[model samples]
Target: MGANPRGCLRACSLAVRSCLRSFIDEAGVPPAFIVGLSGGADSLALALTVIDVASRAGIEVVTLTVDHGLRTGSAHEARRVADLAASLGARALVETVRVDGRGGPEASARDARLAALRFLALREGAPVLLGHTMDDQAETVLLRLARGSGPSSLRAIAPIRRDEDGVTWLRPLLGLRRADTAGACAQAALTPVEDPTNAIDGPWRAADGSALRRSAVRHSVIPALASALGVDPVPALARTAALCAADDDALSEWASGLLAVSCEASPAAGEGSLALVVSEVSGAPRAVRARALREVASRAGIRLLSGVHVDALDDLIVAWRGQGPIPLPGGRATRVGRGTQARILFEARSPEPTRDGG
Candidate 1:
């Protein structure tokens, strides 16, 4: 906290603007950015910070509050957030999204939100901004750990990145704790509504949060870790994620370079896929080989490539005896070849012809 609310707000604003300026300097300034407002303290603080910074920089920006229709009061919250943006002389709108029953309610809601934001960003030719703080990063890492995810799972909440839709996503508050956002909101005299789902009172989990699976991890698991550690563990967990992200980034770069030299666009019956040269992949280090295979899967829009899939691809190159297609997500797979002339192709399986019941 600061001596007063204004001082605290100013400090928070500085933290955010500094990060944004550095990101723009490195990644090249986009035409503008669209901030996602949820009426929560984090997002309210972000909306304020972004408007102030963009105003100073003379950048045209907009705010969007996605109403997922998952809860009763969501529309009201969106309206409030929009009004806040308007008060600051910024353009804001509420984008309603239909949550499809996929994965679960929580996952579905997330997908819907991302889809809405990405749609807006692409339509406006600008990047999307989020207000994910260090606490969110910690919760994600903990959830991934519980799920037995790999190093990639540990790379939680990237500070900034471009998604598959070619829309850039920025999270300027990841370096700040969740408390800082609340402080920022307080400083700016912004009383954002408390999201009941995020409230964790004592050891008893809120009944309302049951539908949001992440709340379990955020409320229970994270607090348990902090209690056992005898101090707050969020910053530590976030730092670990940062380190993992750096390693993942380096490996991805290496794999990208390898793909340029050792892979080719497969002429396989078109899903627009890639092929890895057997000789090249077989000779490369395991790390480079595994990452290259993942890059191949990602390019084919198969992001659910598991370690088993990667290992199966490895077997194709090192222990090939003409294995059948190793299954991947999105109806895609990797098929092995016999020799140095063979190209391990990442291809989508053709749909089986349907028989008429008549």
Candidate 2:
């Protein structure tokens, strides 16, 4: 921590300005942008820094605080965040969303929050900024590592990403640590809201009553690992994620080129169906082939393909042995034809009807 609070604040401001400058250089500055402010230390610091940077650039900043309505006092907190943003010379709004408990509370809340943010961004025709720090990236890599995730999953969070809906999400704090944000907030005299869900011993838990995976990782696993190693593991893990991201980008580009040559629309199969020429795909290395397979499935509207699904799909290419159609979540894959004429078809499944007639 810097001895002078103003110096710490200035350092954070410079870091944020650098990130914004990079985006401006690539995409040009938008007339305005939306920042997701949760009133937490990370977001509070980001909002303050962004407000300062944008003010100097004459760019409008709108801070949006989403109230997930999962816990008591959330609405009040949202309002408080908005008030702080207004005081900082930026427009602020509170978006209230209902979490339907799909996929689990954590996942569901995230989906809801993002949905709201995307909606507002689309309406305003602006990009969305978020406050995800290096510590968060470390936790994500650690969690995915325990699950035996692939390169894509282990890449963790990208510093900037454009959603399929044409909304660009920017994370300016990815290079900064969690402690940096907290210190910055203190320097600026901002009192951030403490989220109970982030507590390891908080009420939020899995169905089995264990602590939430991220909270446990943040409070227990990282500390224990640091103690055992006699060094802080966050920067090293975050560096690993950055390296994985670069490798994944290269692999993705290669896979995309292969897909362009091998994949085509299959009108005979069904609407929005895709056909992959087996001869063209089978020649590629398995790593590239797996990526191409996943891309084909994703284009066919299957978003959640596990490693098992990709392996089974790969079988349709190199391990073909007269296997039948493999059923997937939203579609099915089948091998057709023979030799040079062989093609793998992905088609959407028709929805099953309810027992009661419409």
Candidate 3:
């Protein structure tokens, strides 16, 4: 806690050991091998720490570095990470991939990186590990808050997520900070690369600055609130997020039972190409209705959704006077006409019947 890199490294090692052991025991994920490596401090530290932990547990470790090919020195940096990982006692591999940075540069790089990791995991038959830290989550929440997002968005990111491709992605360092990750990497004698893009000011710069701001909010703002308002805002907000997640989970389960899955975006939709049917989304509770509509929109491949969009869908459910249809953010809605069976058929811009080809 004192900004000591060695201490942070030790703590990170302990955390990695605990998470890997627990995941093996509970999630049935094999411990013999884990995949993830980059020249970045967070990932390098994670790879080194995982090797130390897994070796003690009689498990083998492998490191995979995905060169996004976005920068000039990316491939060379990947090789350095591989060499360092090998010295750390992991069987290291590197794969360079072409990425266009489409659909927003950061997101596209993330997609390409994750796709490479998933491929590596499947090929190696192992779970892939990531180095997203708690600081990252806090920053994400702060960014979402600035964008006027909802509770789930404010919850930031999940520690674990599984893809339909059977890839289990784990973030064992969610409770650690970026500064701590750097400290750990230094203690491990691993020199991490500083991606110039990370420090550069651009549209994505706020994404990084948000974390610094969030730390201030957590360490400074919340305590100020506690002193002035006689309450800790951090704990209160965290508890609210937990409650919202619980309610959201329940709503999702209920909606799953009530609504039928018509189509899901395979490659996923980015713009207004997504759509869901009213037949499957109607007659549910407001919570369930919101979730169903969002899922449809998501299946249509939209990533960022606004609260207003959900509210508009809610209004459609209740105050819908069948006057054609209202305009949605990602797409337009049309009532089309009365159905043969007296049901109102609602369709979005792309129409409904497109299936996800995953």
The top-ranked prediction according to lDDT is 2
Per-residue alpha-carbon lDDT of model 2 for 1-358, expressed as tens digits? 2333366576677777888898899998787878999999999999999888888789999999999999988899899899999999888999999999988899999999999999989988888889999999999999999999778989999988999899999998899888888988887788999999999988779889999999999999999999999999999999999899888889899999999999999998888999999989898988899999999998987668888898999999999999999888889999999989999999888677888954
lDDT of 3 at 304: 51
Of the candidates numbered 1 and 3, which has the greater TM-score value? 1
Estimate the TM-score of every prediction: 0.84, 0.92, 0.70
Superior candidate under lDDT, 1 versus 2: 2
Off by over 4 Å in 1: 1-7, 23-31, 200-211, 265-274, 297-303, 325-343, 351-358
Estimate the overall C-alpha local distance difference test score of candidate 3: 0.67
Better of 1 and 3 by lDDT: 1
lDDT, candidate 1, 1-358, per-residue tens:
2323355577667766887788678777767769988888888888888888887788767899988887788898788889888888678889998988577655777899888888889888888889998899998898888788656779988888887688888888888887889988876778987776565442223245443557777778878888998999998999889889888778778878888888778665475777778787677778888888888777766677777888888898788776788877765565545556777777765555778733
lDDT (Cα, 0-100) at 313 in candidate 2: 94
> Which consecutive 10 residues in model 3 have the weakest lDDT in total?
336-345
- Report the error of model 2 at residue 248, Å: 0.9
Q: Which segments of model 3 are wrong by more than 4 Å?
A: 1-6, 29-32, 200-244, 257-285, 295-312, 325-358
Q: In candidate 1, which residue pairs clash?
A: none
